[model samples]
Target: MELELVRLPNGVRIALDPMPGLATAALGVWQRVGARWEPAELNGVAHLFEHMAFKGAGARDARQFAEAIENAGANMNAATGYERTAYYARTVAEQAPFALDLIADILFEPHWAPDDLEKEKGVVAQERGEAFDAPDDRVFEQHQSALYKDQPLGRPILGTEAALKNVSVDTLINFRAMHMTPERVVVSIAGAFDRDAIIDTATRRFGGLKARPDPEREAARPQTGHASETRKLEQTHLVFSWPSPPAGSDQLYAARMLSEIFGGGMSSRLFQEVRETRGLVYAIDSATDTLEDDGRLSVYAGCSAQHAHEVAEVVRGQLELMAAKGPTEAELKRAKAVTRSSMLMGLEAPSARAEARVSQLFLRDKLTDFAELRARMDAVTCGQVQAIAAKALEGPACAAAIGPKAGHGALEAFGAK
Candidate 1:
């Protein structure tokens, strides 16, 4: 993939990747501010700010703003993550100007109002409640607390109800003014579009953004633990974590393979041994979360309350076995193929490309195109996988489980014996 990158005098970046015959385009503004950017008092304010951005901006109120884009075709909506907030739009190639204008309006010209804040608080609160009510989601929250301790990274993106109540209009506006600056923003567009026209539109919309320096964000504090609590639920939800490589490191390639082979797919060792073989879990998988300074390779399993202890033991044993013996050459080959297939499939969509581009640039200030990324994956060896598994095992393994079971959600109390 060829990239056309430009930095405006004000420090805002523009990345354009044109797919010649595609009929639609996706453009998004990626900002380097999220829950981690907030202080303890303002736990979920970043997310609230994201909600408020859509409440009103410029002349179009939230309803009109959404209508304009939907009328033009933006089936996909904006999203907020732990490290960034993205406002993106997809529309006909010719509607590029309108889409960018509307998205930029959301990103740069939010109409902060006390009324909107009061109303949106309820919506955000409801969303938070829903997340807490779901056992799968609750398990991850418990896991985050165990893995990140009292740090902001452990704070839920939706934040607590108390935090939302404390957020006033001034806090919202000031936070945006401080973090939503040119130097910390990346504008990315992909699919069929006029490059020159898109550039001019971005400059006009974002050029006036001040190059205000972003304050240094708090680094995520790493943590480890083994604790569980009782919840009157039907099935047990388990989230276990170990050490892994940070983002932008070559070890990430190996980490990806480790995660996949560990418990990723149907044919994975854990899924085969714990589920198909033992009927231990209804759903099980391995996932990784990598930040600039810290990372985790975690496995999640939802099983009958009676089988929680057995599931945990099997998972631990799989890691130990892999570390000692390493993945077979056939397993290594399959992992690489699965990873490549997933990446290639995601590339088929313009929005995916836009998100990938912004993420790479925001995290590392460089985009590793398909060829480079493929080469990295292609270069991973079984030795690296074994070494990663061994090092991961050396770290404290944290376990968090939520369910009403024989042990009342405590996997450790269930007796490893």
Candidate 2:
């Protein structure tokens, strides 16, 4: 794997990882700001800004933006995450430069028309409603809100209906100016391509933009204790979140391994014990989400209203067992192998590689080679995994459950137990 980092005269930084013989190239422009950076009044501005980017730019309107890329036989899309927003394209190796230019134009030249803003407000409002109607989605949102409490990081990415309604053209334009700077952006490319030519084109196009000072971000600290809510639905969706180490910590890897062992796959302990053996529910899993300053380890389950209480106890029991006895040597080996193989398989797609590179650069400030990542996963031992699990599950876990009002007792009992 060859990695080259280039800085344009205007301050845009581009990183290229060239993999020879791959037919398709993945490309992306990632901004440093996301939902967490928005001011209280502009809670959803980052995501709203992402939508406005496709409205129009340069000589291309929204339709033209789509047509121009499809004309080149490329697939393009964008996504907004907690801490970043990314615009991406995957195309034949030769069309990679055009994709990069299109992305740059959209990012720097979006024409935020008042008419479009009005129309988009309705669209985002509908989106907000849709998300709220989905029990699973609302449950996660409620969990994050409960876990982080008053922190900006705890807010929903889709902002409230009132906030989305009030987002004017000027608001989005001001947001663009504050957060969309070359210094905070990263352009990453992967696959068969001329690395130097790609960098040169990106530099020439994006290098003209002036860099702005990085915006201030709120420092996020862990919120201890528990929170719960009751709702009306069929199956209960429960999420248990506990504070964990921030990204780049050695414990982060251990926590990930622990998640895999506990609930990662069909063969994982949670799946086998909860869903397979007990027939407790259709889905059960655990995940570790680590940020720059703080992180969370969550165990999620969807179960019948009647089984909610028992399932929670079983899940906690599994954690307690892990804390006491630790994972066996064989289980640790299998979990590590599973994680390493999954990582290797995911990189086969150029688009995945591009996203991975941009995420690493933006979130962790470190470029990780696949080999090094695999080695790190391989180095996690059973003892370290157990210790991390014990630390993560030691205290009162925050719980959020959404289902029929009848199921509230089960959830409340689970928390109390």
Candidate 3:
């Protein structure tokens, strides 16, 4: 893939990942601020701001924003994560400029009317209630809370009901003013498009935006101690988290492979051993979350209340075995192929490319070429995977399980005989 990096005069960074023969284009604006960046009192403001962006901007009202993208024969949406919020639109190559303009308007010119803020507060409150009611979602939040406790990283992106109720137009507007500066944003375009023309458009549209001093953000590094908790539900949701590598670490690549081998797919050890062989779980997986300073390796599983202990044992056993004996050569080969193939398949869509470009630029300040990523995956070895697994899985770890009262005892057995 040919990648171009353009820095506008106003300090906004633009990354273009052009696919030569495609007719579709994906464009998005990515901001570096997210749930983690908010002050404790402003927990979910970043996410609420994301919702408000679609309410109206410039000449486009909410209805107009929807119609304009639909008329262009495209899909438009946005999401907020632990580290960033992204607004994206996908359309034909010819409509790329319009899509870009619409997104820019939404980001820079939200109305944030008082009535709209009141209405959205109710909507977000409902959304928050729904999340709390869902066992899968609620359990993960519990796990995260226990794992990172009292830190910004542990705070829910949706904030509390009281917090959401108190969020006024002034709060959101203040947040936008402080965090949505050119220095903290990246604009990305992917698929068939004229690179020079897109960059020119971006320069004209975004080049004059003012830069602001970035707000002081809390440092997320320095290991927090392990913690755990129990809750009431039908199935037990167990999570194990330990400190790992930050993004761009040499060991980070190996950490990715380790996560895949443990639980990335149906063929992975966790699935094969916990579900297929023992019928202990309906879902099981492991992942690595790499931030700017520190990272975590987490394993999650949902199983029958009666089987929670067995499931935890098997999951822990798999990691212990991998640490002691390393992954087999065949396991390493399959993991690499799975990782590479997943990357290739995901990039086939214009929106995927656009999102990928935005994420790379925001997180790493670089465009990740498919070929280079594949090469890196191809080069991981069993020794490296085992080394990372041992390092990440070592020492006491945190676990949170939400299930029937009967399952409370299972928490005590995690990483235990």
Lowest summed lDDT over 10 consecutive residues: which window, candidate 3? 221-230
What TM-score fits each model? Answer: 0.95, 0.94, 0.94
lDDT of 1 by residue, 1-417 (tens): 457788899988898888777999888888888888778888899899888867767788878877887898765467787888888878899888778888888766788789879999999989988988998998888778777777888788898888888899989878888997898889999998888888899999989998765678778666657556678887888888888998777799999999999888998999999989999889999988888777888989988788887888788889989999999998889999999999998788898898888877877777667888899999999999999999988776677888875633345732211
**lDDT of each prediction vs. the true structure?**
0.83, 0.81, 0.79
> What is the C-alpha lDDT profile of model 3 across 1-417, one tens digit per residue?
478888888889998888888998888888888898877877888888888877878887889878888999988888898788888888898888888888888877777898998787778889989987777777778767766678888889888766676678888878888887888889888898777778877887788879877787777743433333456566776776666788767677788888888888999999999999999989999898888777877888888788977777777788889889999898888888888777888878777787777767766778877788777778888999888878866654667677675665556666521
Instruction: Give me the displacement of residue 379 in model 3, in angstroms.
Output: 1.5
What TM-score would you give candidate 3 relative to the actual structure? 0.94
Ranking by lDDT: 1, 2, 3
Clashes of 1: 0
Q: Which should have the higher lDDT, number 2 or number 3? A: 2
Encode model 2's per-residue lDDT on 27-57: one tens digit a residue: 8888878888977777888888887878878
lDDT of 1 at 18: 82
